[model samples]
Target: MKLTQIATATALFFTAQLAFADNPETQTQPAPAVEFLLPSVEVVASPPSTPLFSITDPKAPRQPLPASDGADYLKTVPGFAAIRSGGTNGDPVLRGMSGSRLSLVANGAPIEGACPARMDAPSSYIAPESYDKVVVVKGPETVLYGPGASAGTVLFERNTPRFTEAGVRASGSLVGGQFGRNDQNVDIAAGTPDVYARVTANKAHEGDYRDGNGNTVPSAWNKWNTDVALGVTPDADTKLELTAGTGDGNARYAGRGMDGVRFRRDSVGLHFEKQNIGKVLRDIDARVFYNEADHRMDNYTLRETPPGSMPMAADVRRRTVGGRIAATFDLSERVEWVAGADWQVNWLASRSVMGIQNLSDMPWTPSATLSNYGVFSELTWFASDVQQVIAGLRFDRAAATDDRQSISGMMSSMPNPTFDEQRTRVLPSGFVRYEQNLRALPLTWYAGIGHTERFPDYWELFSPNSGPAGSVNAFAGIQPEKTTQLDIGAHYRGGAVDAWVSAYAGYVNDFILFTYNTSMGKATSQATNVNAEIFGGEFGATWKPDGHWRVGVSSAYAWGRNADSGAPLPQIPPLVTRFTVDYTLGAWSAGALWRVVSSQHRYALNQGNVVGYDFGPSGGFGVVSLHAQYDINKRTQLTVGVDNLLNKAYSEHLNLAGNAGFGFPANTPVMEPGRTAWARLSFRM
Candidate 1:
């Protein structure tokens, strides 16, 4: 169905409902006991809940129109950026770090995408609204989730639900906007004291958008997802749950030679939890999960085939299986400890067909397999009322195997130098921290040091065309990356005012880097190692002068240099700041957000990660947005917003060069969407 038709139908339905809700008879009824509060539209994300740790509700209304994917949503957080690839599935970067440095977990399991070029990053499969909570832990501060989190860790989780009696509850949202943008979501749950079931689903679509110059950009997409969970709560303190989910989508990218014609996901999981087992043993948690991503990209699916080029497509898939077991212990009155073990394995395979050949008929070829096993323990010591200490340690055994029989080059296939070869390494990571609270003021401060040893991932090992100098291949030449860092932060929470600042400095040994080179009209990439130094920080403050007024400001910056070459690191985001002001009166609220980014004069041309490479220096730009919300009742809310209010033409420094096949000039960055407006109606029962 056409997006405009869908938007018009949705508008008529919502209008009728609003009118019915205003009827005198309905107005006299008493509200339900379970009042669903509608939070003001989130512009700039709130300050961290604790030093370097942030928690936010994923379901909350946010500006820049509600995000279509996880990476889009994370842009609201300080120190977070994305390498744009059209309108959706941008690769997320944290503190100037991307790829495997940042760990992403969903329901305690890791899901990896299959695209060698990172067309479908891990965040691409995530539908932010389908989850209940988002937790971001910056820096390598903890060891409970997984290993090699030198950048940070992001967790998307769902809380277990319990009921005292048999009952049913549901929540939903409908949104429509310009450029034929629309979305629909529904979540329903039913439960009794002993058992519960839930179903969540959503669909999103958008047409090609125009830039400030009113030129069309090839950035259209459609996606849908559905997930279900069933739980058995035999007792109040113990529960078991099972979950299954499937989703698929397609996206058009103006920065690539092909469009994503398929993004398919399948997953299943089992979880068990028991709390308050004894005085010393507080809780035990165990979970197992299996996830698979089947992705396909083509030149003729979402757009016209380029002149003189035949239709071509590639299909890739990755299957991952993982499990974890953890237990919490109250060792003493002043000390608490949590310990866990985890194991993960994933395999990648692919097939390609050209010249009107059927891709499905091509036999899939297994390319690589990777695995990791780790044990971890974290201890927190409450020494006194104002002083605390935290420490963690983990050991991981990682291994990768190359299964390819031959390497495909620009002209012809060649024998694989490292075919059927395997590499394994035993690595360790740990952290120690000290935190203190001021006795005379509402302030807390912390300092920590952490170290992590990371193994080479798939992209660094197999995607590159060549390895470092004097090496057989990337799979055999790349060495493990070791990072040691120090972090310090402070936060103040006084009545009407809240503020936070976090900073880090790190040195990396054998940091993996990618270099792009084009020769004879063909592009190639090579993987190499270098010594690097990195530092960054994020700061924010919020002031609530009165019950009806709120003002906030946040800023973030990162700097990195290649210690070996004395050159600036590629793909680093420039300094950015956000300002927001909000006013609330009764059930109505209004807000505006202004975001400014500094010009990035420092860059390493043709060097970056698998997602994108630095094309050249980029200029900075500023944009403004505004939003307003009205509560129709305790259970319903309507939010409207205008994005890019000034209709500015801007492009982020961390962006891909426009593809020639899309009729874009060479070495040009894709522009962001122009001025657009949208509205969303949400209800809970």
Candidate 2:
């Protein structure tokens, strides 16, 4: 800590930050800099030396959005699907796998909410416009992110910035749409030779939407978020950055039993990047993050209740703290190695009361804590110009501990006196892949095999009433789920357009299933050690048929079956297809899109549908949309689009049913959002 030593460390640190700047400039400032640490590098992006897709490419037309939760964004890519939960926050599924199978990482941090009902899911906290990149890896392709993700891993990242010359940059947008909806967004940044700062904010609001049937459904929502970032960039490949943000919003659900009264989030994180770390290590990254969510739900909001009826209410909050440090080593031109360790801890609690008077008598339970730690390593080697190899391994330890105990309410009637011990387990996962390039055929072929063993998450444990048979609930009973799978795909790109197709098959030991009964208002779900199999694939094709016209088509399908029970898995998306055609001239481009989905008549027996339980096998429907965009210049663009152009009446297979107290009758069904029109204007400065 001497002045000379401090000076040396500061020089090395600032030099790293300099790398992230788009411009090479250094300024002298006295503001104190904060540092953060992150777990490890996810090696699944591109096995060896290949490049992955970038979210910022201006020429790449954005993928259209569907009536969905954020999971639709994930499904746009190959090897992705979701278990629909009405309209938003759909449970993301990977290669026919769901629940805790997929990993969600925000700003290099891992988080899981505490509600057994999953009302406060981790993805609910993410905003599409807030991040710079979204990467999805199918199947246990990588192990550096978390312990169990038997399905895959998703990474949401905001880029680190650097400064060259003294200047300021800004971008803003305003969007107005039909169905009582509108939005405004702004992104501004300023920097000098040595420092850079960025701020982004956005607000969106919408009222109740009607389905294709023209029937109004209670689907109103309003949300806003702001982010501030600061960085010091000294070189082209290094950066020291800090970020903080706070967001709050409310979303009304027509399919759920309760509406999200409050969705508040606070996040803080720090990141550091270093290139040329040593003789062998090429890059070093460190980051630390803290994120929290406070969510509330009630029956009276967004719906009509019976006269003199007591309201049903619930409130829950969760917080996660995590950090990691990782290094990438380049042993030689043909071989690369990555090593790192990560740890995350989450704490959450909830309070609920059912009475004619909001709150009559009920004690709020103490907080529940779940902790986890893991270390992982991965290596990549280029065997030849036509071949490459990748291998990875990871080990994890996780546990849930209760500080307070009581037989609250409904559980008091049952004899529950054996729950004082801690729950813990060790899990290991690994994967290997082989890729070959066929130059003559203009094709790339890749095949990979992976295995994952994930410990039971909080939702799979304490939320259920039965476990592997001996214990009273999954909390003390269920064992880790083990999964092994093979992934193979091919990509062809030798013409005006490019195309890729990927597929996967897997076997899961101890698949987790949830069973619900409406009469008793009880759900019996458990992680049974039964065998299961799943498979699916997606294909994308884009063609520049003519100079002024372009055609694009994408399709996906998935299937899953419980080998032991001989039944289809619940909540799986059915066969779906999409087509689009666009024509452009001078400064304007017009496009029309069509989507068709087949009915999901095949599902598990007595399984829960998108609603609470087995309530629907919605009829198939078709939707069409039209979009037109005008480009004024390189820095400004305007886009206008009309969704559900036909205004057809239809409900999604995964829709939540209508509430009896709400305007909807007990026999009525939930409705989808009605036809809407939207216009967007963007300006860059």
lDDT of 2 by residue, 384-463 (tens): 98888989999888888754364343445344454456778888899999988897976787889999988877777666
Best by lDDT: 1
Off by over 4 Å in 2: 1-69, 78-87, 354-364, 407-418, 521-529, 608-616, 663-669
Q: What C-alpha root-mean-square deviation, in Å, does candidate 2 show against the real structure?
A: 9.8
Candidate 1, 357: how far from true, in Å?
A: 1.8
322-400: candidate 1 lDDT, tens digit per residue: 9999999999999999999999999999999877788998999999999999999999999998999999999999999
